[model samples]
Target chain A: MRPVEVGHRGGERAPRSTRLLGRHELPIACEADIVLVRRKARSLAQAYGFDAFATAAITTAASELARNCWVHGGGGAAVVEELYDGTRHGLAMEFRDTGPGIGDVEWALAGGHSTTRSLGLGLSGSRRLVDEFALETARGEGTTVRIVKWKRF
Target chain B: MSPIPILRIGTTLLCSVHVELDDALAERLQEDVLGTIERTGATGLVVDISGLETVDSYVARILADTGRMARLMGADTVLAGMRPEVAATLVRMGFPLEGVRAALDLDHGLALLAHGRSGATEGRRPGRTAP
Candidate 1:
């Protein structure tokens, strides 16, 4: 059996940006992977000169989204990309999975409603931690969440 | 793998989290802590998290639950040594540290625990010098 894949596939264009400084791909198959994702995001953000608060925020967002992929999505892939678009620098991450998709996007994003008895802050809190947030999912297909945090001058 | 060590000091237990914990490790730490409390009959737990870089919702939940569970077992819990940025992120995420006392550092945490142990119904200790 072939392993599931995510992020930018062949024929799918990369993110619209003038230059991508760095890119990394990681597979999220277990709880340890979530910790790795956070570390990867933190190092990348620090390398890109993110402030301490921004770095913490980025890493927290990565941890939350990666956990979603592992817990709700039943494992997936994460792609972290550093972006430089003319005047601004940014870090973007995409968490994708081929597992059962979320049935109610609204309810999931509402916060405090969880299937795993958690605080249910993963989706809602992650959205607030980043500068840009986008989620795409189909009930029977899969779910993909993308988030970006921009470096401030 | 060895479980996170919980050191006993007098009637208190000190558990310092030095690494980022996944769910399994966090659960293990929880069980170890509770079991230690049961065996030692400790009345206070000080969880030092200065080594942790980030306290996400999951880690935050584990800390909160540990505090609550310790309370149920007749123990007071003090969360110590949180980084400033981590604290800011936690507040922004709106995940409050429920039922746990917050201290600036390990010394303050220990002092608070000591105060709680000695002063069940007494007023503040005058000319109090940190132990």
Candidate 2:
């Protein structure tokens, strides 16, 4: 019922230092929420001075990652962060879920190999679009996927 | 808010999916397309995604599934007007448009369904392009 009941405890330290912008959340319960994530991520990337292709890549990756959080991970949350590593600015997203975690990390990221009749590009496609990507998960434990896309000078 | 508009253009059902597709909207569309097929005996369906440049995997699945569902009920489905960037994103993402009969443009989708209404070549699956 309460999709976004995760309490907006968004702003934290560490990432705030390198991530020089505000934090936004995408409360994923249903499909429409996925759309919201895409738009929000795109806008954040634009605000950080990413180009057209970079913007598209960011939004597209956001959409896929958010969908995975909701669809495969049994409804979770997405956090978008504006990052700046001093010289270059960037965008980072963290996807978290309490659902069943992935079994094989390698298999899941192999592209077009979904067990749920999906296009199977969520993990691999998203990784390719961004500058950095990391995944942490166990079978019973939840999953957390963090990705970052930095703007080019 | 009104559901996505399903326009009756001649004997074909034209659905322009320009809005950001949520799960509920996609399900509603599936139901409407199938219901319209039975209600109007329409021979073809065209879902225009030209206006939409971004979509997730779930949205793509819904479109593909909608096409497959329409086929079972004797109606052909043609997904039309995907931007090049969107197409590139989809391919790069590894989400195949399985079971989707595609047209590069809306007019092509309409033509593909209009002239090729045999309902016999449903299994073969040939793509169409607008002239």
Using DockQ as the measure, the top candidate is: 1
What is each model's TM-score for chain A? 0.87, 0.86
- lDDT to native, each model: 0.84, 0.77
Task: Please write out the lDDT profile of model 1 over residues A1-153, one tens digit for every residue.
Answer: 122222231122334654888889999998889999999999998888999999999999999999999998999999999888777788889999987888878788878887885699998888778777778888767899988787779
RMSD values, in order shown: 5.9, 7.0
Residue pairs of candidate 2 with colliding backbone atoms: A32-B22
Tens digits of per-residue lDDT for model 2 on A1-153?
112111111122224357456788778887668888888988887777787777877898888888888888888899988777666787889998887888777778777687774668788888777777878786667788888787777
The digit string of per-residue lDDT tens for model 2 on B9-44 reads 777999998777666777788888788889988878
Which parts of model 1 are misplaced by more than 4 Å? A1-17, B120-131
Candidate with best TM-score = 1
Candidate 2 lDDT score at position A63? 84
Candidate number of the best lDDT? 1
By summed lDDT, the worst window of 10 consecutive residues in model 1 chain B runs over B120-129
| Model 2 segments more than 4 A misplaced | A1-19, A26-32, A49-52, A113-117, B115-131
